[model samples]
Target: MSVRPLTEDQRDAMQEITNIAMGQAGSLLATLLGVFVNLSVPRINVLALSDVADAIGSMVGRNIEITAVRQSFHGYLRGEAIVIYGRDGCKELGDLMGYDEVLDRTDEIELLLDVSNILVGACLGGIIDQIKGITEAHGAGELSFSAPSLMAENVPAEVLINPDKLTWTHALLMEVNFTLEGRNFISHLCMLMPGGSIEKMRNILDEFVASF
Candidate 1:
């Protein structure tokens, strides 16, 4: 499916919305880890599934072992939200969460899911809340989502890029990076909205901007 690229104005508005959501997510992480979370400016882009890896590498660097968890959301818009952690970062997270000295594979997986649930839920909830606020303020319908489940983890980027895994040919990708101050931990949160929902989001963003 062909979709128009987002205008600068639209991108700015979306960036602001994503910034708000990322702030909420950062706060939640700070509370969970008992450390300050430094967030980079959110980035918005439209790209095909094949191009996602390059974008991620640009943010997280190259030749890193990445672990990601994905959760799908639906309502007025539908998409998948991914929380990615580098292998070393995952170990740091495990330590911060107070895991045992030697963690088995199962233990590591559990920790990853636990953290993923917290981060994904907080981020997606914040986004939905903002969207709902806009719609309610403008007298539009509410947006909602289902409970997030662990879709994949510790999977290679190449494995993840299989055509069968990506339901949409293209998506609007929003990325936000988080770093734990005084620690070696870094994480990237990415949200992908399909072309169909991108149009819906664009219309809603237009209405949102006009209201202000």
Candidate 2:
């Protein structure tokens, strides 16, 4: 069965929280890459694990090949964040970020991981701060993240996520993307939280709404 894990109020509040976080992420990326960053509206939903690949495709475009990295976060909040880059693999970013020579496969992966670390860390940090402010217990603990690792390279988005291999049936997806103005660089950050974390998000959000 299809699932909607978050109510409308929860979804909207989360979107606003993520909007603030994404803007922070974009600012940090722009400073790092030495290019103007374009931020997309945060898209929030609860979707089936089976449909995540298609949802990713819809964001990045149909069948477009991609490079991606993932970092898993745990603590008071839990989720895995996937950072997706387009098929050209961010040569533009390398140039803007002061890499004068062409990046070999290893160098490219390293660059992607560097960018992923900044984006995921700043974005999640912003959201966590807000959640801590609103969490009723006031003891909402901090989140800790694993180092970013390469997930997929130059693969079609449709095949990027395999549903059968995932442990969860449904996830709350919070997605946002950053684009570099006048450069061939775009990155989509998709944060997927399973049922346990979804319940935590719902509780925190309810407290937030009640306080206002």
Candidate 3:
């Protein structure tokens, strides 16, 4: 089966979907952190396999501290979203987690996973509900893989997915960045959609935008 590459329009639509999704995420994050959260124009990119390391490297270099959370969801749709939080953002989060001091590398990872468990879950829930018409707009938090060392070590981890199950036929990596105040947050949506689902995703995204 030939992979149906996303048209520029589809990419635009996906970015819009992320804007909505991340807006909701930022709001929830604000409530969690007890700070006013401001979001910047989200940056979106789709990457080839070779570029993955470069992409992650650029983001991690922006700050010495990094925290990441990852969650996996499956049903009519299957994929994962790994949310990366910056060093200062982790500090803000550590404060929320009731740690009276800075989080060590391990502490940062745990905090990131916990926070991502909430924010990434909510973002994916909204997107899945909108696109798939599957009302299972929820996430079951599980630790597929996570490590504070992954961030503190300044090394990027490659995402592992069942390549043949990916919806786009090709293994597509959708990434978007969120900047609130002066801190940057990155959300990586790694979707493994079967080839049959792209059209449905387009339709759902269209309907979602029309309703807005």
TM-scores vs. true structure, each candidate: 0.88, 0.95, 0.64
After TM-score superposition, the amount by which residue 210's alpha carbon in candidate 3 deviates from its true location, in angstroms, is 8.6
Tens-digit per-residue lDDT, 112-151, candidate 2: 8999999999999888877777653666656789999999
Residue pairs in steric clash, candidate 1? none
Clashing pairs in 3: 166-193, 167-193, 167-194
Worst lDDT run of 10 residues, candidate 2, spans 133-142
Q: What is every candidate's alpha-carbon RMSD to the true fold?
A: 2.4, 1.4, 5.9
C-alpha local distance difference test of each model: 0.78, 0.86, 0.53
Residue-level lDDT of model 1, residues 1-212, one tens digit each, is 45568988888889998899889989989999999999889999988776766666676666666777777787667888877887787679888888768677677767777777777778877777767766676565654555545555655544444546667788888989899999999888888888788887887788667768
* lDDT-best of 2 and 3: 2
Q: Higher TM-score: candidate 1 or 3?
A: 1
Q: Give the TM-score comparing model 1 with the true structure, all chains together.
A: 0.88
- For residues 90-173, write the lDDT of model 3, one tens digit per residue: 666676557887678677766666776666665665565345432233332222322212322232333222234333433345
